[model samples]
Target chain A: MPDSEAAVRKRIRGLLAQLYGGDSFVETVSDGISLRQAGVSSHALVALLVAMEDEFGFEWDDDVRPEALRSIESLAGHVLSLQE
Target chain B: MSGYANLARLDLAYREDRRIRVRDGVELYYETRGEGTPITLLNAFFLPSPSWRVFTEELAGSYRVVGYDLCNHGKSSHVGPEPTWEEHAADLIALLDGLEIESTHLIAASTSTILARDVALRHPDRVRGVVLAGPVFGPRGMRRQRQVQRAWLRTLESHGIAGLYEHMYPEVFSAEMNEAIGTPGFLGFREAFSALSTVDDLVNGLNRAMEDVGDPAVLAGVERPALVVVGDDDFLMGPTAARELAALFPHGRAEIMPKAGHVPFVDDAEGFQAIVRKFFEEVDARA
Candidate 1:
């Protein structure tokens, strides 16, 4: 991963920790953690998305398919792609 | 009885009561009146069927008007731990099934419009027509308004029922209406608001559910004829959102009532009723 991508990922990790309660499992970004495993229910995911939109100054496009949000890696990638 | 007393007696006599059990064993509270073609009325956020008192009375003479309090509101049991929009829709469908209502028209306002749309999308076979008034979809500019509402709800939670009632009066009713309606009726409104204030679980669960609401596209597929009504003075849901919602319906038209606020039914009942009666007549003609 490029230096910028890594930085973005690190920032996301920090946000996840703050929002979902920081823990060792969340810190390890190299090992992917699913939203479910990270204790994010469907309701919490929506809240997190809203918070992220407010925090990052970008709206998460709902036009995209739900499959895009299946895993944490995918969600991170989606966020990163939006940043680009 | 005197003419006024007789009129009051007639009003009191006009009510229908029934019990309906849904698939999940949830018993829905329902009341029906009038004769031809059932017209189901859904209440807005936290308000119950009684909120539709004037609206129901106006239409009950012509149509089989049915109004029911959703679960967690009014006399209905809050048996389910979480009250999602889907659950509300299910309760509506269950009420229909129990009443043996094969098909009917629907009229919903504000938050209840969410369930109305869901029903139209999910159970198209049952919905003959739909009328949505002051539909409250959190569009882009409404963020600040939503924040205000959230803050008000928080105040309700922290300060107890009396405090909530004091704070909610201005927001719930127009100044003119409040003055004209008098204190006793206003106190009744306060009691309703207080009842809603106490249902914290419903509020929290509904807030969470609203966050991930898919999109208007879910409502895009509804083929039934629909009428979208909004008050010109409804600052909460501006005219633009009303237009957008109207466009979503396959067979839909928009009507903006002049000089009316959020609850146009309350502000101008005669005008609102005329619009609804006319729309249902058109739908009936088409059907």
Candidate 2:
């Protein structure tokens, strides 16, 4: 897992970008942007979680709070907490 | 009479979006277009009527295509008996009666195939032909469907509707088909699904079983020309189960569509529409 939150956001952004068709706009999105604004559909949450789990090499405990999935920063925090 | 009276005001010649009350007083949202032989489309349990938007618009150029949301899904009245598809079948027959359709071709996907089959058997003279896609019926098909239905309820309990859709995606559409439709297209479908779905509604709908779940034995009595179609990649109920379903009907035939999954229309729209159009035409010709 990434040691710092910055690295975690970068990784999360890249993964989300891929789900969004790898468009450059997704790459440049600010960390604070809402998931809906970032083109993270409610439908893609599971796919994103799967990708993140595979990329980070950790299994989700099957109980992620919906708020933690609100933004890149929030998701990074969630992932880093789990790493601890 | 009220149901028939409601239909009297609507302009069925072109296009109309409205809910016609069934004999039981439950309203079902429906859209009808075109002017030829009537064909009613029954979507899978998870999908709303608009999932058939593209196909409905195209088919309306020829056949009088009627697409509707089943009770407890989409814009239809959710007050009906949940999971008892005998009511769903009755609602369908009532819809046809309200529309003044004496006989029509029936196209149903997944679990809805059971309802269509029930209608064809009970009202043999009313069905011109039948198309069953990714049918979760028959002896083996029903068994497999029960197992998967349990998984769906559990998935919904832990991960919500998004997880449920994800679990169903692979079983419903192949990788190639998913890529072909693109992310935006798939998202649109999911958005529509999420808009009309809830955990309780889905659980109730998944619990859906009818009087005929174990009764493919009765299908031999159906003399209607039946076409069973399955996506080769459908993990849930593949070609074998589909063929089993077709064999039950006296005039039935089963065919496989390549690079598709459970939801053949979404997976291979062009091929699905082509095969069905041909089958309906053949049935109409023999009439």
* Candidate 1 Cα misplacement greater than 4 A, ranges: A1-84, B1-17, B138-148, B175-188, B195-197, B201-209, B212-214
Ten-residue region with minimum lDDT total, candidate 2 chain A: A59-68
The residue pairs that clash in candidate 1, if any, are none
Worst 10 residues of 2 chain B by lDDT: B3-12
Instruction: Predict model 1's lDDT versus the native.
Output: 0.65
For model 2, what TM-score is found for chain B?
Answer: 0.87
Best by TM-score: 2
TM-score of each: 0.66, 0.73
Over 4 Å off in model 2, which ranges?
A1-84, B1-17, B139-141, B179-192, B210-212
* Each candidate's clash count: 0, 0
For candidate 1, give the lDDT of residue B12. Answer: 15
Candidate 2 local lDDT, B199-283, one digit each (tens) = 8778888877423455778879888999998888877666777787788889999989887777776655657778999999999
What TM-score does candidate 2 get on C-alpha atoms?
Answer: 0.73
